[model samples]
Target chain A: SQTIHQWPATLVQPVGSPLSLECTVEGTSNPNLYWYRQAAGRGLQLLFYSVGIGQISSEVPQNLSASRPQDRQFILSSKKLLLSDSGFYLCAWSRGGRAEAFFGQGTRLTVV
Target chain B: QKEVEQDPGPLSVPEGAIVSLNCTYSNSAFQYFMWYRQYSRKGPELLMYTYSSGNKEDGRFTAQVDKSSKYISLFIRDSQPSDSATYLCAAPSSSGSARQLTFGSGTQLTVLP
Candidate 1:
């Protein structure tokens, strides 16, 4: 079975501070990875998605960026955090084409 | 207008009652549809998935997709308190290349014991 692991399940970062959230998938290779920010009543907004290593697509322009360093390792980062950047961040993986996506536990980030 | 739309409902129901959740989309090109459940402060969990139209059932959950109407629905029979959560409907990107998904605002359901 495949499992996704996200670190720092909860984080409290101050404004203008750097942010780094990691997500790694085990038991799957070359999977499509995605980063989404979920806000209350706004649904899950796709921030970035990667089909392969070193390839990332931004769905919404903001203060966040994503990277795929390895086949199953994805990272979401920001040089400086903003108050609006606070939300429930989720990491998901799917097969190459269209398929059911599996999500991680998520990281609750609060930018003060 | 948004590609997908769902009622942001905080619906309350009694235990053992039937629960119905719904979503509507404006994009006809969307071919795949899905439903996800999310607990407080957690990630959305894929509950049911259907392609195109028709109905698909899994245990106590039934998923219905009406391509003609561009609407999808999820029904939960014999609902329990454990089933209380936010339900989100998702559709595939029209482009189909990235397999991206556009999600609904989600409906919050609470089953009282």
Candidate 2:
């Protein structure tokens, strides 16, 4: 069985501060990884996705970025946080060229 | 217009009632459809997915897709309080060689006990 791990579960940061969220997958290799931000009544917004290491495609242009350092390790980062950058962030993985996605427990980020 | 759209229903129903959720997409090129369930303050969990224009059932849940109309539906039978959550439908769009998912604004359902 494959499992995705993301941390920290919750975070409270001041404005203009840097942000770093890590996600990792176990029991699978070369999986497709994605970062999504879900707002209340706004739906899940795809921020970034990576098909392989060192390759990242950003869907939405904002204050966030994603990186695939290893085959199963993905990281979401922000140089400076904005008040609008607060939401429930989710990390998900899927098989290459497939649509069935498995999500990790999300991180609730609050930028005050 | 958005590629995919869903009714944002804060629907309330009694336990053991039948529940239905639906979504519509604007793209006919979307070959795959998926449904996800999200609890309050949690990540959305994949519940069902299909590529063809038919119905697929798993236990108490059924997923229906109509490629001709670009419509997707999910039915939950014998609904319980645990079934209370937001249901979202998605379709994948081509992005380079990879694919990025586009999701609908979820429909919130509460099954009271």
DockQ of each: 0.76, 0.76
**Per-residue lDDT of model 2, residues B1-113, tens digit only:** 99999999999999999999999999988988899999988888999888879999999999999888889999999999999999999998877666778899999999999
Can you tell me which runs of candidate 2 are displaced by over 4 Å? none
TM-score against truth, every candidate: 0.97, 0.97
Q: Give one digit per residue, the lDDT tens place, for model 1 in B1-113.
A: 99999999899999999999999999888888999999887888999999988999999999999988888999999999999999999988833456888899999999999
Q: Candidate 2, which CAPRI tier?
A: medium
Candidate 2's C-alpha lDDT? 0.92
The residue pairs found clashing in candidate 1 are none
What is the DockQ (computed on Cα atoms) for candidate 1? 0.76
Q: lDDT of each prediction vs. the true structure?
A: 0.92, 0.92
Report the backbone clash tally of model 2. Answer: 0
